[model samples]
Target chain A: MEKVVKILLADDDLEDRYIMQDAFSAINLAHVPFLVEDGEKVLEYLAQMHSDEGILPSLVVLDLNMPRLSGTQTLRELKNIEHYKDIPVIIFSSSLNVIEMHECRQLGALSYMVKPFTYEEYLLSAQHFYDFCLSKHSFPEFNSLINNFK
Target chain B: MQEITHISLDTDMDLVLVHKRTMKLGELAGLSLALQTTFATAVSEVARNVIEYGHDASLMLGIMADLKEPDKFLVATIKDHNNNLTDRINGGLVYARKLVDKFSMISTEAGVEIILHFKIPGSQKIISSRIEQWIISFNLEPPVSPYDEIKRKNKQLQELAEKLKESETQYKELTNSLPMIIFSMREDGELLYANSWLEEFTGETLLQLNVNKWANVMTPEDLAARWEQWYHHVAENKPLTQEIRLKNVLTNEYTWHQLSAFPLSDENGKTLYWTGFIVDIHARKVMEQTLKDNRELQEIKVQMEEKVRELKRSNLELEQFAYAASHDLQEPLRKIVFYSDYLYKNYSALIDERGQLYFNNMMGASQRMIQLIHDLLNFSRIYRDNLYLEKTDLNVIAAEAVNDLEIGINAKQAVIEIAHLPVMFIYPIQIRQLFQNLLSNAIKFSDEERIPHIKIYALNGGKEIQLIFEDNGVGFQEKHLDKMFSLFQRLHSREKYEGTGIGLAMCKKIADLHNGTITATSEPGTGARFIVTLPKEVVV
Candidate 1:
């Protein structure tokens, strides 16, 4: 019996979401990963925990900037909550500032990745993300950094 | 008593002495003297009151009995008069009230009746107030009557003194500062006093200006006659006006003096003094000549403008004529070149070597003449208009100019050094031409033994830009230094180096148009340096 590996992905644009979906199908991760339009819904699905019949995704991919709540804000808020605090949040943002990558990681982001400016680089970064989720690594084995609190 | 008295009435002459009973004699030996004065004063006032208010005045002289003792009698009675009396008879009544020990008054159809009793100690030297008031208030003392006229004269004399002091101070101030000679003389023409203005006008004081001593210094002419006429006026009390010719001791120039004199008199109607004033009218006469000079200067200014316009007009015509003449001349010179080449191609061996040499010389001279004409025209028209400025890189322009003449530069093996060329405000074409002409000349005139080396440097002087184009070439004699920028003034003959001799002249003109300066220094056979300084912002 093979266990179903669920993945949570958040982005703002519909066109990007569709293109990412097609890319996932091409990369053979379509069955394992699920998609949401923004970081807000990703947190909502995680909070339900059993709303989809007890399926808890092992991986969550986040975008840094979006309309309702920006990726940095969502990431900062999620790190504060205890139950969702350990969830792996990788910020895949459309900013190229090296300082921004350093800041996102400092804010307890599991990983910080810059969205590629060109089409070929975008496909390659997504493929690397697809391969990481399929490896089936245990979460507790990864590093945990506590974010700052005021 | 009913009036606010501005002038007292009763004391003006005398006071009333009224005795109603018989007199007490041997009152006191000294008391009668005092009482006598008192009684006289009172009686005089009573008489005066009688005259002023009643019709017929009378003196009242008697005695009065004391109220307690009939034997002790004092004098008391009204000075009687007969008429309808005025109410003003109270002047004497008031005198009697303050004087006697007991006094009373009653008015009747026979004037007013006043009664007074004078009582005092027998040893006393002072009389009672009744007697004292009667004597002094009525002016019975005779000496005080004479002082009235003296007081009036003293007041008049004081006012006259103050007025005379004020006028004297004003006269001193006016005379000392007046730009003339002022004097006062006796009516017979003897000088009395000279104002201190003589010190300023004649460089001599009043004492030095005595009439007898300085008569000749005052005027060379017959000024005695002038003084005679002036005296006639003072004697007749008429004004004197005249102009006398006087000589300046230093300049020896005779000057005309405007003289005016008038008579002054003492309190007596006799003429006592004559005052005169003299002013030099020479300077005022000289001012009239300056107006004529101003007119000539104005005429010269107009002529200068016309000359500048004529020069400008002729310059424009000359530039256009040069451009047109050169264009027409170049057409025929080109045809001559084409026909000579055509003849050489058609006839190969028809001419000797000498004929070929003659033809080459002809072509060479023709080409040289064309270049000379071109240069002559460029010099004539260099200052046609002001140089136009735009942002320019002199290095780039210099490089391009050097490249344009690079073939010649390489042919001469000349070493040119350029350093720190600025991005500046300049005319690209003109500057390029400037660099081309300068650089080419440096290469063309290289020393036969040494390689030609040229330096182009610029210095930034605030409000101006300066440049130096220096070269180690065959420089000429210093004797021709003054003519370096003159048109067609050349040191080297055409055989050695070909030039129209207008290059330096053109450089000078271009520099001037930009509100700049240019100069040259050279050593024979060594080199020449052309220094140019241009204002950073050309003055329009």
Candidate 2:
């Protein structure tokens, strides 16, 4: 049996959080997604997972614009932690700003994804993200799977 | 008139006696040495003619004053007793005609008479003789020795030398008194003469000055180029003019001077020497420099003004873009939210549960986008509109904002305490918007259990007015203070706080529009205090 993938999502918009959670459910992927509203809670959740017997997520999805600690700041903080460096992070934003996208990449984001306008585009990206995670864990040699999103 | 002197002309030796007597008359008449010789020569010629033609004759000499002249004339009359003396008088009158002012023959009934006139020197009129009758019978002295004639000639030459010396002294005084430095340089760059004026200017003697060593008194940087120009003019033997800086002996500092030179050429066009003068041009050069600097400053001022105009134009362009983004981009987003809501209500049963969820999410997103656009519109409108400022009561503006937020205030159970505010010059709409945004934020971010408490007050800060908004509610962390007023920056999740993240940004924009400043102080779980400072007089 394949191990269930645990994914952490940080987004300030409630609708966007619901959309991502729904995308995971509609795709029927074997994943447990934990959601947080902003970058500040994301840090709290990560620290709780370290202290408690909670399992760390295989991937982290971050929205660029949030209340307090932004996605770039969180990425910088996550990369600074030696143990969390290997966990690939994906940057998601509603804006099509290439400068922000490049800025996230420089901050060690594994992939940058723009929020889709339609339900169909959302479903396709969710399926792609799920398959990337499965390929990332099952075949460690295929870690370059993030390139498909690029 | 002088007494007449008579001399016999019978013997050839007697003509010399006539010459001596005529010369004596010249001396008594105060004639110059050259005129005295002329008078004596005329007398001898007349006496010789009388001797050659008549048997015996006598010469009478005297000085006679005329009516038209300041001085007298020397008159010599030869009386002849021989027959037809007028016809016998040959070239005597011709010789005397050239030497005397007048020569005439008077033939009387018994014999003939010849009268010759010589004008004394220093007479106002050169021809001082008119026809006059005279008769004299007097004895005159004989001629003096040759040594006496030579002595007179020597005295004349000595007097001429004195006159020449006086003229030379006057020329030297004229040249030395000039203000300019006049100098003469030989073809080989030798100083033949430098006037006293040059010596006074340089505070040095002309004999000690070196013509080729002018570079010693010139500025080092200008020496080589000016010397090359000087040498080129010399080689070409052409008249040249140049301006240079030379060290003033009096001031010991470099000063501007203009040198003008003319080459004195011989008949064959070979340059003999160069004569020139150096005139001070320091004052004129300074004025020229001042004009040049002022012109350059004017050019820079024009360039700076152009740059400022360009910056203003670019700012106006950016404001236009913001206005367009809010007004045009919001319409489509509103339609999207409306259509999504309509579809969800009318066709919910046909779509699956997951599809229904996605539709609701889309509608929520569109609604948020519309709110974002509305906030942006207000932010840009504050800058885009032409300001109409007037004295307005800020307390009344705050009350209106609170009245507009009554619904939200009641829902949050918030209490807003307002103090008396001052009347100041401000844009009414923008000031009202600022108050509304701050009031809405205070009511919206209250704690769940405790009722929100807010206070609005004003204080005079000397040159400026300070308006303070204090809220006892859930505040942001101190670390996020810098970004509190940035556009689309929020400290709480959208679910917890209903905002498009533009309230504080709008407030900041309103403050900046009035040429004021806005700052906030807050800590996590503590209350927030926002302070706005505005000048008493708005420049705009």
Candidate 3:
């Protein structure tokens, strides 16, 4: 029996979410990613899944800037919970700020990636997210991923 | 008794004359030299007592015969208006009584009288007429020896010395009572005398102060320089006037003092000594220092206000730039690019050739807008960003810039000649950006008739280094030099030259950030030389 790979993504922008979805589908990944609007919704979705005794998502992706709760605040809350602490999280942001990336890593993000602008770049980011979940490593290598963007 | 001579017993010099007249009487009375000395000594002692402790006193000398005996006597009588002779009779009077044959003192309501007699030989018959002759002979006698004149002068000198001593005591009291430090020093700067004020103020004696040349009472910080000036003044034999800080022993605090010294010279112009005074000027010095500090503070406050105004203006500009980039401009442009691409990809069958061409034009315009926004953001960030300086090789930065513009260089078939450049302390990223912009400009503005040629070299100008980028390209008129570095100031139209018009402005800003300058020399149709002068080492 093959286990299903489930992913959750949180973003405030509708267009960015749509593009992300389209990029995921274009890559022909086996599982559909669960999407939420902000960091608050991410916590709520996880709490509901825990209450219903449903399967938790395998990986979570977050946009750095959001309304109400930022990606850093959500990551801090998610890492504090016993059931969600083991789940891997990645931060995706439009800002190419090394300081923010380092801060996200310090806050227990498995990886940090820049938001892709083009369709081809989005496709590549989606593939990297899928591979990050499958590897199940504490820290993932991002050298090749960053080099491709350059 | 026959009175031979009489004299007023007034001053000490009168006592000397009394002794001389008594000796002459003894000689005239036929007394031996030994008896003459005894009788003179006895008479002079009584005279001295009258002068020292009596008022309205006189002395008379004569020859007398006692009624009870056949003996002649040389008698001297001393009288004073004071009747307190009993208390006035000191040891000299008792001694004088022993030297004479008879001595007696009587006190009356009118005055006091003292008489002395020395026995004379009867064989020396002196008649009344002979006594008159004796008196006349005494008056006719001159001073016998130089000893008399010398003795008189000595007495005068003693009186003068006494007067001088009294005046000196008065002056010393006056100096000691003064509030300031008064002192005298030797010509060689050794402390000679100081009044009570010196010890009262410094709590140090003249001996202790001279040990270190008053260093203990002075502030150590002001010592060396003050000493230098003092030595110079002494060497030049000039009056010294200086301000110094002196420490108070009780408070252990320093106060400013004005010290002045003048050399006391002799008639021959030889320095005798130096007279100096030290007066407190602490209050005046404090006020002057306070005024100076306040002036400096006022200047600093004005400078701070100017900086704040400049900061506010720049901050407002940054806010407007951010607002336009984030909301007014970039957001709509992003949507247009996104939607246009989506329509072109998903609905290509419904679009005619002209519609596709129009879509392409829209995409091109949006792309250029994105570049413009990005450049504007970079320009604003130059102010917002913290500068990080590192020692960087110019050759590496120039090579990287050439590599970054490789496609443009290939398209234009541009040739770049680079001379060896020095390593300098610089913001590496900004310098690389500057090199890239200049290289790209050289290639893009190449003349149609010639292949693009660029030469980059550095000239070391001691404190600064000038990096020159020479290009054989479509140059500009020299008159437009001021407008060239201004923001969005393009000399040519967009049809001929494709640009956001922020490249040279960004270059100028980068040069300013490094505390450097950027300028260019150009001819209208030939070539351009862009020069950037930068400090060899950046100060933090």
For candidate 2, write residues B466-532 as lDDT tens digits.
9999998888787887798898898788887778888898889889888999998887577888898
Candidate 2: which docking quality band? incorrect
What residue runs in model 1 are displaced by over 4 Å at the alpha carbon? A1-150, B1-166, B177-194, B207-299, B345-348, B380-388
lDDT of each: 0.64, 0.76, 0.83
What are the clashing pairs of model 2?
A: none
Candidate 3, superposed: residue stretches over 4 Å from native: A1-3, A26-31, A47-55, A79-88, A105-114, A118-124, A131-150, B1-313, B316-324, B327-332
In candidate 3, position A32 carries an lDDT of 62
TM value for model 2: 0.39
* Residue B295, candidate 2: C-alpha displacement in angstroms: 5.6
Question: TM-score for every candidate vs. truth?
Answer: 0.48, 0.39, 0.53
Interface RMSD of 1: 31.6
Model 1: share of real contacts kept: 0.00
Q: How far is candidate 1 from the true structure (C-alpha RMSD, Å)?
A: 27.7
Q: Which ten residues in a row have the lowest lDDT in candidate 1 chain B?
A: B1-10
TM-score of chain A of each: 0.75, 0.84, 0.86
Better-scoring candidate (DockQ), 2 or 3: 3
Q: Which stretch of 10 consecutive residues in model 3 chain B shows the poorest summed lDDT?
A: B323-332
Candidate 3, residues B1-540, lDDT tens digits: the string is 888877777788787788889888888888889999999999998888888888889988888854556788998999999887668566658889899999988889988888887899656666678888998886566655565555546756988999999999999999988778898988556889999888888889988988887788887768888888878898899999999888888888988999999999999999899999999899999999999999999999999999999997988687567744543465456666666777777887898999889888887888888778767866665642545798899999999899989999999899999999999999887898899999899998899889989999999999999999999998999999989999899999999999989899989988988989999999966989999999987664
Ranking of all candidate structures by their lDDT, best first: 3, 2, 1
